[model samples]
Target: MKKEYFRYINTLFVVIPMTLIMAFVGLMRNYGFGEDWIIKFLKAWSVMLPVAYFAAFVIIPNARKLAEKITGKS
Candidate 1:
Protein backbone atom coordinates (compact mmCIF):
# COMPACT_ATOMS: atom_id res chain seq x y z
CA MET A 1 0.00 0.00 0.00
CA LYS A 2 2.50 2.58 -1.09
CA LYS A 3 2.25 5.48 -3.43
CA GLU A 4 3.41 3.22 -6.25
CA TYR A 5 1.12 0.29 -5.61
CA PHE A 6 -1.02 1.49 -8.44
CA ARG A 7 2.04 1.75 -10.62
CA TYR A 8 3.07 -1.76 -9.64
CA ILE A 9 -0.35 -3.06 -10.55
CA ASN A 10 -0.18 -1.21 -13.82
CA THR A 11 3.15 -2.87 -14.47
CA LEU A 12 1.54 -6.26 -14.02
CA PHE A 13 -1.22 -5.49 -16.48
CA VAL A 14 1.16 -4.07 -18.99
CA VAL A 15 3.87 -6.66 -18.59
CA ILE A 16 1.56 -9.63 -18.87
CA PRO A 17 -0.11 -8.40 -22.01
CA MET A 18 3.20 -7.24 -23.33
CA THR A 19 4.70 -10.64 -22.64
CA LEU A 20 1.93 -12.34 -24.54
CA ILE A 21 2.54 -9.98 -27.37
CA MET A 22 6.28 -10.46 -27.13
CA ALA A 23 5.92 -14.19 -27.09
CA PHE A 24 3.79 -14.09 -30.16
CA VAL A 25 6.15 -11.69 -31.80
CA GLY A 26 9.12 -13.73 -30.70
CA LEU A 27 7.77 -17.00 -32.00
CA MET A 28 7.01 -15.31 -35.25
CA ARG A 29 10.30 -13.54 -35.37
CA ASN A 30 12.27 -16.61 -34.45
CA TYR A 31 10.29 -19.42 -36.00
CA GLY A 32 8.11 -17.54 -38.40
CA PHE A 33 4.90 -18.66 -36.79
CA GLY A 34 1.90 -17.07 -38.38
CA GLU A 35 -0.63 -15.04 -36.42
CA ASP A 36 -3.05 -17.94 -36.16
CA TRP A 37 -0.15 -20.21 -35.23
CA ILE A 38 1.11 -17.75 -32.65
CA ILE A 39 -2.30 -17.58 -31.12
CA LYS A 40 -2.38 -21.33 -30.87
CA PHE A 41 1.12 -21.48 -29.50
CA LEU A 42 0.31 -18.87 -26.87
CA LYS A 43 -2.80 -20.76 -25.93
CA ALA A 44 -0.73 -23.92 -25.76
CA TRP A 45 2.11 -22.38 -23.76
CA SER A 46 -0.12 -20.24 -21.54
CA VAL A 47 0.45 -16.60 -20.60
CA MET A 48 1.92 -14.85 -17.55
CA LEU A 49 3.55 -18.07 -16.41
CA PRO A 50 6.08 -16.35 -14.11
CA VAL A 51 8.32 -14.75 -16.71
CA ALA A 52 7.01 -11.33 -15.79
CA TYR A 53 7.69 -11.93 -12.12
CA PHE A 54 11.38 -12.50 -12.76
CA ALA A 55 11.74 -8.75 -12.62
CA ALA A 56 9.39 -8.68 -9.66
CA PHE A 57 11.90 -10.82 -7.79
CA VAL A 58 13.61 -7.49 -7.28
CA ILE A 59 11.19 -4.81 -8.31
CA ILE A 60 8.14 -5.74 -6.20
CA PRO A 61 9.84 -5.79 -2.82
CA ASN A 62 11.87 -2.68 -3.49
CA ALA A 63 8.69 -1.02 -4.53
CA ARG A 64 7.05 -2.35 -1.41
CA LYS A 65 9.89 -0.99 0.65
CA LEU A 66 9.49 2.47 -0.79
CA ALA A 67 5.78 2.10 -0.38
CA GLU A 68 6.21 1.06 3.22
CA LYS A 69 8.40 4.04 4.02
CA ILE A 70 5.82 6.37 2.59
CA THR A 71 2.65 4.62 3.79
CA GLY A 72 4.08 3.24 7.02
CA LYS A 73 2.52 -0.12 6.35
CA SER A 74 4.78 -1.79 8.84
Candidate 2:
Protein backbone atom coordinates (compact mmCIF):
# COMPACT_ATOMS: atom_id res chain seq x y z
CA MET A 1 0.00 0.00 0.00
CA LYS A 2 0.90 3.63 -0.36
CA LYS A 3 2.31 5.56 2.61
CA GLU A 4 -0.84 7.53 3.41
CA TYR A 5 -3.00 4.41 3.24
CA PHE A 6 -0.56 2.50 5.38
CA ARG A 7 -0.48 5.23 8.01
CA TYR A 8 -4.26 5.30 8.30
CA ILE A 9 -4.51 1.53 8.51
CA ASN A 10 -1.77 1.43 11.09
CA THR A 11 -3.49 4.13 13.13
CA LEU A 12 -6.83 2.30 13.08
CA PHE A 13 -5.32 -1.00 14.17
CA VAL A 14 -3.37 0.60 17.00
CA VAL A 15 -5.84 3.22 18.21
CA ILE A 16 -8.98 1.06 18.38
CA PRO A 17 -7.68 -1.62 20.73
CA MET A 18 -5.61 0.80 22.81
CA THR A 19 -8.47 3.23 23.28
CA LEU A 20 -10.86 0.44 24.20
CA ILE A 21 -8.54 -1.04 26.78
CA MET A 22 -7.51 2.28 28.28
CA ALA A 23 -11.05 3.59 28.43
CA PHE A 24 -12.29 0.42 30.09
CA VAL A 25 -9.54 0.49 32.69
CA GLY A 26 -9.91 4.19 33.33
CA LEU A 27 -13.66 4.11 33.72
CA MET A 28 -13.54 0.98 35.84
CA ARG A 29 -11.02 2.63 38.11
CA ASN A 30 -13.17 5.69 38.57
CA TYR A 31 -16.67 4.16 38.62
CA GLY A 32 -16.24 0.52 39.65
CA PHE A 33 -17.69 -2.44 37.81
CA GLY A 34 -21.37 -2.87 36.92
CA GLU A 35 -23.73 -3.14 33.94
CA ASP A 36 -24.22 0.62 34.10
CA TRP A 37 -20.50 1.06 34.12
CA ILE A 38 -20.21 -0.94 30.90
CA ILE A 39 -22.70 1.37 29.21
CA LYS A 40 -20.89 4.44 30.43
CA PHE A 41 -17.55 3.07 29.40
CA LEU A 42 -18.77 2.42 25.87
CA LYS A 43 -20.15 5.94 25.67
CA ALA A 44 -16.89 7.45 26.80
CA TRP A 45 -14.85 5.21 24.53
CA SER A 46 -16.92 6.35 21.56
CA VAL A 47 -15.92 9.93 22.20
CA MET A 48 -12.36 9.18 23.15
CA LEU A 49 -11.37 7.07 20.14
CA PRO A 50 -11.62 9.81 17.53
CA VAL A 51 -9.97 12.38 19.76
CA ALA A 52 -7.15 9.93 20.40
CA TYR A 53 -6.75 9.13 16.73
CA PHE A 54 -6.35 12.74 15.73
CA ALA A 55 -4.22 13.59 18.68
CA ALA A 56 -1.89 10.66 18.08
CA PHE A 57 -1.18 11.74 14.53
CA VAL A 58 -0.46 15.29 15.66
CA ILE A 59 1.49 14.42 18.77
CA ILE A 60 3.53 11.49 17.50
CA PRO A 61 5.49 13.42 14.91
CA ASN A 62 6.35 16.18 17.36
CA ALA A 63 7.21 13.62 20.01
CA ARG A 64 9.53 11.81 17.61
CA LYS A 65 11.22 15.08 16.78
CA LEU A 66 11.69 15.86 20.46
CA ALA A 67 13.08 12.41 21.14
CA GLU A 68 15.55 12.71 18.30
CA LYS A 69 16.65 16.10 19.56
CA ILE A 70 17.17 14.80 23.08
CA THR A 71 19.26 11.89 21.79
CA GLY A 72 20.99 13.96 19.13
CA LYS A 73 19.89 11.46 16.49
CA SER A 74 19.83 12.78 12.90
Candidate 3:
Protein backbone atom coordinates (compact mmCIF):
# COMPACT_ATOMS: atom_id res chain seq x y z
CA MET A 1 0.00 0.00 0.00
CA LYS A 2 2.22 2.82 1.17
CA LYS A 3 5.22 1.33 -0.58
CA GLU A 4 3.34 1.07 -3.84
CA TYR A 5 2.62 4.77 -3.78
CA PHE A 6 6.29 5.48 -3.17
CA ARG A 7 7.15 4.38 -6.69
CA TYR A 8 4.59 6.76 -8.16
CA ILE A 9 5.98 9.63 -6.10
CA ASN A 10 9.49 8.80 -7.22
CA THR A 11 8.33 8.74 -10.80
CA LEU A 12 6.76 12.17 -10.48
CA PHE A 13 9.93 13.63 -9.01
CA VAL A 14 12.04 12.15 -11.77
CA VAL A 15 9.72 12.92 -14.66
CA ILE A 16 9.01 16.55 -13.86
CA PRO A 17 12.61 17.72 -13.87
CA MET A 18 13.60 15.47 -16.74
CA THR A 19 10.75 16.73 -18.90
CA LEU A 20 11.33 20.33 -17.90
CA ILE A 21 14.97 20.29 -18.89
CA MET A 22 14.31 18.36 -22.07
CA ALA A 23 11.46 20.64 -23.08
CA PHE A 24 13.50 23.77 -22.47
CA VAL A 25 16.54 22.52 -24.34
CA GLY A 26 14.55 21.09 -27.21
CA LEU A 27 12.44 24.18 -27.67
CA MET A 28 15.44 26.45 -27.38
CA ARG A 29 17.34 24.43 -29.91
CA ASN A 30 14.54 24.47 -32.42
CA TYR A 31 12.90 27.82 -31.83
CA GLY A 32 15.47 29.94 -30.05
CA PHE A 33 14.72 32.01 -26.95
CA GLY A 34 12.12 34.72 -27.40
CA GLU A 35 9.13 36.30 -25.77
CA ASP A 36 6.89 33.43 -26.77
CA TRP A 37 9.30 30.81 -25.53
CA ILE A 38 7.37 30.46 -22.31
CA ILE A 39 4.17 29.75 -24.19
CA LYS A 40 5.85 27.25 -26.45
CA PHE A 41 7.51 25.56 -23.51
CA LEU A 42 4.19 25.38 -21.73
CA LYS A 43 2.63 23.67 -24.72
CA ALA A 44 5.48 21.23 -25.02
CA TRP A 45 5.31 20.59 -21.29
CA SER A 46 1.64 19.67 -21.42
CA VAL A 47 2.40 17.02 -24.00
CA MET A 48 5.70 15.80 -22.64
CA LEU A 49 4.65 15.51 -18.99
CA PRO A 50 2.22 12.65 -19.48
CA VAL A 51 4.33 10.94 -22.08
CA ALA A 52 7.42 11.00 -19.92
CA TYR A 53 5.46 9.93 -16.87
CA PHE A 54 4.12 6.87 -18.67
CA ALA A 55 7.50 6.01 -20.09
CA ALA A 56 9.18 6.39 -16.71
CA PHE A 57 6.43 4.44 -15.00
CA VAL A 58 7.01 1.51 -17.31
CA ILE A 59 10.76 1.82 -17.55
CA ILE A 60 11.76 2.61 -13.97
CA PRO A 61 10.90 -0.71 -12.42
CA ASN A 62 12.77 -2.72 -15.04
CA ALA A 63 15.61 -0.28 -14.85
CA ARG A 64 15.90 -0.76 -11.13
CA LYS A 65 15.99 -4.49 -11.62
CA LEU A 66 18.78 -4.14 -14.16
CA ALA A 67 20.69 -1.82 -11.88
CA GLU A 68 20.44 -4.26 -9.02
CA LYS A 69 21.73 -7.00 -11.27
CA ILE A 70 24.57 -4.87 -12.54
CA THR A 71 25.55 -3.81 -9.06
CA GLY A 72 25.10 -7.27 -7.61
CA LYS A 73 22.87 -5.81 -4.93
CA SER A 74 19.44 -6.93 -3.71
Candidate 4:
Protein backbone atom coordinates (compact mmCIF):
# COMPACT_ATOMS: atom_id res chain seq x y z
CA MET A 1 0.00 0.00 0.00
CA LYS A 2 1.05 3.59 -0.60
CA LYS A 3 1.63 6.14 2.12
CA GLU A 4 -1.59 7.92 1.18
CA TYR A 5 -3.56 4.72 1.73
CA PHE A 6 -2.48 4.50 5.35
CA ARG A 7 -4.67 7.41 6.33
CA TYR A 8 -7.82 5.63 5.17
CA ILE A 9 -6.62 2.35 6.60
CA ASN A 10 -6.06 3.99 9.94
CA THR A 11 -9.54 5.48 9.83
CA LEU A 12 -11.10 2.09 9.12
CA PHE A 13 -9.18 0.40 11.92
CA VAL A 14 -10.13 3.14 14.33
CA VAL A 15 -13.74 3.62 13.27
CA ILE A 16 -14.81 -0.03 13.11
CA PRO A 17 -14.04 -0.96 16.69
CA MET A 18 -14.91 2.45 18.04
CA THR A 19 -18.37 2.35 16.56
CA LEU A 20 -18.85 -1.29 17.45
CA ILE A 21 -17.97 -0.78 21.07
CA MET A 22 -19.99 2.41 21.34
CA ALA A 23 -23.01 0.82 19.73
CA PHE A 24 -22.79 -2.21 21.96
CA VAL A 25 -22.40 -0.21 25.12
CA GLY A 26 -25.14 2.24 24.23
CA LEU A 27 -27.69 -0.40 23.33
CA MET A 28 -26.72 -2.53 26.28
CA ARG A 29 -27.36 0.38 28.58
CA ASN A 30 -30.71 1.12 27.00
CA TYR A 31 -31.98 -2.36 26.35
CA GLY A 32 -29.83 -4.66 28.45
CA PHE A 33 -28.18 -7.85 27.16
CA GLY A 34 -31.29 -9.25 25.57
CA GLU A 35 -31.40 -11.66 22.66
CA ASP A 36 -32.05 -8.83 20.22
CA TRP A 37 -29.16 -6.76 21.59
CA ILE A 38 -26.62 -7.91 19.01
CA ILE A 39 -29.07 -7.19 16.19
CA LYS A 40 -29.68 -3.70 17.48
CA PHE A 41 -25.98 -3.10 17.93
CA LEU A 42 -25.31 -4.24 14.35
CA LYS A 43 -27.90 -1.83 13.02
CA ALA A 44 -26.51 1.08 15.02
CA TRP A 45 -22.90 0.27 14.18
CA SER A 46 -23.57 0.07 10.45
CA VAL A 47 -25.04 3.56 10.57
CA MET A 48 -22.40 4.98 12.87
CA LEU A 49 -19.32 3.60 11.13
CA PRO A 50 -19.36 5.69 7.94
CA VAL A 51 -20.60 8.79 9.72
CA ALA A 52 -17.93 8.47 12.36
CA TYR A 53 -15.20 7.75 9.80
CA PHE A 54 -15.93 10.99 7.86
CA ALA A 55 -16.47 12.94 11.03
CA ALA A 56 -13.11 11.77 12.34
CA PHE A 57 -11.35 13.32 9.36
CA VAL A 58 -12.86 16.66 10.28
CA ILE A 59 -12.83 16.31 14.05
CA ILE A 60 -9.40 14.80 14.60
CA PRO A 61 -7.43 17.58 12.95
CA ASN A 62 -9.32 20.34 14.71
CA ALA A 63 -9.10 18.46 17.98
CA ARG A 64 -5.35 18.06 17.61
CA LYS A 65 -5.00 21.77 16.92
CA LEU A 66 -7.11 22.60 19.94
CA ALA A 67 -5.07 20.31 22.14
CA GLU A 68 -1.85 21.82 20.88
CA LYS A 69 -3.14 25.30 21.54
CA ILE A 70 -4.24 24.40 25.03
CA THR A 71 -1.10 22.52 25.96
CA GLY A 72 1.32 24.78 24.12
CA LYS A 73 2.66 21.78 22.25
CA SER A 74 2.32 20.67 18.64
The TM-score, computed over Cα atoms with residue i paired to residue i, of candidate 1 is 0.45
Q: Residues 1-74, candidate 2: write the lDDT tens digits.
A: 68869988888889999999999899988989876997899899999999999998998899999999999997
Give the per-residue lDDT of model 1 (tens digit) for 10-74: 77776777677777676777668555785666663464536675676677779989999999888
- Show the colliding residue pairs in model 2: none
Candidate 2 lands at a TM-score of 0.85
Best by lDDT: 3
- Residues 1-74, candidate 4, lDDT per residue (tens digit)? 89999999998999998898899889988999888887898899889999999999999999999999999996
Instruction: List ranges where model 1 is wrong by over 4 Å.
Output: 1-8, 34-36, 43-49, 57-74
Candidate 3 global CA lDDT score: 0.93
Order the candidate numbers by lDDT, best to worst: 3, 4, 2, 1
lDDT of 3 by residue, 1-74 (tens): 68979988888998999999999999999999988999999999999999999998678789999999999999
| Alpha-carbon RMSD, each predicted model | 7.0, 1.4, 2.0, 1.4
Residue 58, model 4, lDDT: 98
Off by over 4 Å in 3: 1-3
Whole-model lDDT, model 4: 0.92
Q: Estimate each model's TM-score.
A: 0.45, 0.85, 0.81, 0.87
Clashes of each: 0, 0, 0, 0
